[model samples]
Target: MRLKDKVIIVTGSTTGIGKAIAKAAISEGAKVLVHGLEEDLGLQAIQELGEENTVLHIEDISAAGCPEKLVELAIKTWGKIDAIVNNAAWVVNSDIGTTGKAFLGKVLEVNSIAPFLLIKSALPYLSVSKGVVLNIGSVNAWSGEPNLLAYSISKGALMTMTRNLGDVLPRTHSVRVNQINPGWVLTERERQHKKQDGLSENWYEEIPAMYAPSGRILWPSEIAAAAVYWLADESGPISGQVVDLEQHPLMGRNAPKDPSTIHGKP
Candidate 1:
């Protein structure tokens, strides 16, 4: 019950890591608002987590006014927000030449701009609560992943925002801003990419060792654990830092997933 009596709004929680985070938060006694494009899935989350503990908000984060609406709903329902997790994202696997302006714009808008708006709207409530903002970033924020150029740039911008907001927000308001850079997650997207690349069914098995040196693709559960740790009160002294959850590329290549070789140590 680390988040006992807390209120949190997680964007795009119908599936994937977002859903996992919402589920975890609820399990720890935080009333959660589940948001995403899938109305059915969002409702399902409310049902799964129990209607009393979870609320569903079906919307597209990419839309213009959705972010503010989300914050408003959280306040109306819970009286305050203890945390806001900006986990919604749009991704494109294309080089700059292969990606058109429209695609790039969409990527940046959803990945960077939308999160900014969400934070801006939530800042007032967060300031009063002295809340935390947990941004879900990616390893691509640092990696030069050619195929995911726009996606990388957008995430990189988010990482910068986390740092920028951390400095400015605390001085004027009490809210703390930080980010988590999830490693190569074995999510639906990764599975699809494996199939697209004609990789073996065991592609994920090799991924942890091959790409991350951890010999394990990060599961949604693991990421949720990290998020919860950050959101909880113990992390009050921690802010303005991006926790890189992936293994160091060079060290990871040395002995993938050899628990001893992997660096999960804080």
Candidate 2:
């Protein structure tokens, strides 16, 4: 019961890492407001999590005024908000050639702006509760793959927001903000996306050695497990921090042309 009696609003809780975090929070005795798009998926998640522990709110996270509405919904349901997990993201592939201003704008709206607005909306209650804010970011924020240009920029913005809020909010409002940068989680969305990209349905099972050091990527549950520590009082006064959760060192780790044969030839 690490999170006993806390009320957390988890955006994008209908699926993937967000859903996993909501589940873990509930198991740790937290009440969760599960927000997401896709009415059926939202209902399904609520059913799985049980109405006693959660309430469902379905909305496009990027829509205007959504942040305000979500804050209102959580307050209405739980009477106070203890924390928020900004986990909703708009992920689409784009490169230098395919990228456009409008596309970049929309991606930033979902990934970075919404989280900031949500925090702003919830600030009052959070101040009262001395709450926590956890932003779900990608390792790509450091500088992403070429194909993930706009998404990377959006995440980079989110990362900066996390750090900025983490610094000021904790001091002024006693609200702790932090970020988790996850690398290649094997979530439902990941599997689906890879399959859509023409990979075999079981592509995850046979990942290249360079990508999956341990024959697998991180799991949503694993990320959730780490999330619990930061969300709970256990983390104590730690703010303005960004943690990278990846199998290997993210920066300057060499990828061999043929690892099995080129072991000592680098």
TM-score of each: 0.90, 0.96
lDDT of 2 by residue, 61-162 (tens): 889899999999999988999999999998889998999999899999999999999999999999999999999999999999999999999999999999
Model 2 CA deviation exceeding 4 Å by range? 259-266
Worst 10 residues of 1 by lDDT: 257-266
lDDT tens digits, residue span 6-104, model 1: 999999898888989998998998999889998888888788878898778888898979998998888889899989999999866888688888888
**Per-prediction CA RMSD (Å):** 4.2, 2.2
Cα displacement (angstroms), candidate 1, residue 143, comes to 3.0
lDDT of 2 at 30: 99
What would you estimate as the lDDT of candidate 2?
0.93
lDDT of all the models against the reference? 0.85, 0.93
Off by over 4 Å in 1: 212-214, 249-266
